[model samples]
Target: MGCSPTRHRSQLSKLDSPSKLDAPCITQERSIETPGVSPNRKLLLAYYANETTMNGKLKGLFEAIFAKEELEVTTIDLSYHNLNVREIYHLQFVLQNFQNLRELKLNNTEITSKDIKRLYSSLELMPMMQVLELQGNAICNEGIKYLTKLFFRTMKSLKVLNLSNNRFGDEGIATLCKGLLSLRCLEELRLNSNNIYSRGLILLSQTLCQIKTLKRLGLAGNPIDFESVRVLVRSIRSNVNLKELDLSRNGLSKQVKYMLPEGQAVIKA
Candidate 1:
């Protein structure tokens, strides 16, 4: 991601403009590798972001991208980047230019409450967005406020959302269920490893009943009990549309397997 100092530096000598002073000060170009993909590729994506900084040439890289006459970018995935709040905030500058974006993935980016709010605010720029992946972030109960708000706002356009591995606990799952209950079009939800307890399952069961469009639910690796399993099955009895409900690692009793909808449920091994 090294930029030719002579050309790029000259083009962005005054990268700090007064108009952008009010925007959140996010970090880009922290010592890291380039987000290089094919120029003709429609997706600008990255993986293993947890190992190194996703920042490289902030001004130069995107400047070149925007300078092109034909814009092919539709999806931007920066999963496992281990980004800080400021680093996440700084992405608004680049995202603003990618108005036609359809999917955005920020899994394992160390996102917190304030960072999520900043990310949510940037959604206004992505009107066509359909899929949002925020798995493995640090967003706990308090951090879900922005996400809930995001769900409310994007009900029409958002279809698939993954929030796995965030450890939201029982309280956080309850809060998250509030948002899930209102989604009219969301089809897939991944909430694996979120410290879910009986209370969370109860709330989640109710949410499943409410959201008629939800088809796939990833409920693996939680702390669910036998009673909760029965409650969950009963709550979603009317949801014949449910295609798959994965409860792989929850350590539920063997008897619970009979309670689930025979063909649709995937119980523990």
Candidate 2:
């Protein structure tokens, strides 16, 4: 189900600034290529610095961003916006219009499980998506279920996935592992600062051993003890494709580093 990149002609377009001075505006636009995607893609970088102004004028901002050439937009970064119920719906509506979206960043948006369910449903439209970052949100095990559906149904072209700082626990990791098995092209997976422990790491380690395309893994800031680290090392000991393993800030002793499998991956404990 992985999406193959096809060449497309590139074009640039600009949006008219909203009349109201308080509304968020499009500050920058450029053409950039993802590592494995097509080079002819436009990236729309919209910065809503003031949360109050953004909240009040969310509709106008979305209108301006997706005004005329929604199909040409390849990447969208709306991080740090504290989206509400109505605003999430507005985002979901606009997302369906993006036919070639490759990267979507919604970090620290205060989105809950209910909001993710609605938002993820729209993601099924963008089968060409490559990168998805949802760090620093409120999604828990329930939200992970919705994402698992995305993994099974679409996003087979995904390369970098960041789900750090979402506060999900062992149950969520277990659910995510099932979806991870289906991603044939995933490279980077960031799960730092979640509520995972020994049990979750054991499951994740087993899954990682099977994903040969995975190169970078971020498990920092979790509460992994020595026993879990040993288990993880043993599980992924033969995974030669894994190049980087980030386990920083988990408070493991220096002796634990020595216990890691030699020459397997660059351990950062």
Using lDDT as the measure, the top candidate is: 2
Total colliding residue pairs, candidate 2: 0
Per-residue accuracy of model 1 over 104-194 as CA lDDT, tens digit each: 7888666666666676667756657778888977677767766777677654567788888878778888888888765677888898888
Where does candidate 2 stray beyond 4 Å? 1-67, 259-264
Candidate lDDT (C-alpha), each: 0.65, 0.74
Question: Considering every candidate listed, which one attains the maximal TM-score?
Answer: 2
Worst 10-residue lDDT window for candidate 2 reads 1-10
State TM-scores per candidate: 0.73, 0.77
lDDT, candidate 2, 78-149, per-residue tens: 787677675676677557656578888889877777878889868988788889999988788888888989
TM-score for candidate 1, please give it. 0.73
| lDDT of candidate model 2 versus the reference | 0.74
The C-alpha RMSD in Å for every predicted model, in order, reads: 12.1, 10.5
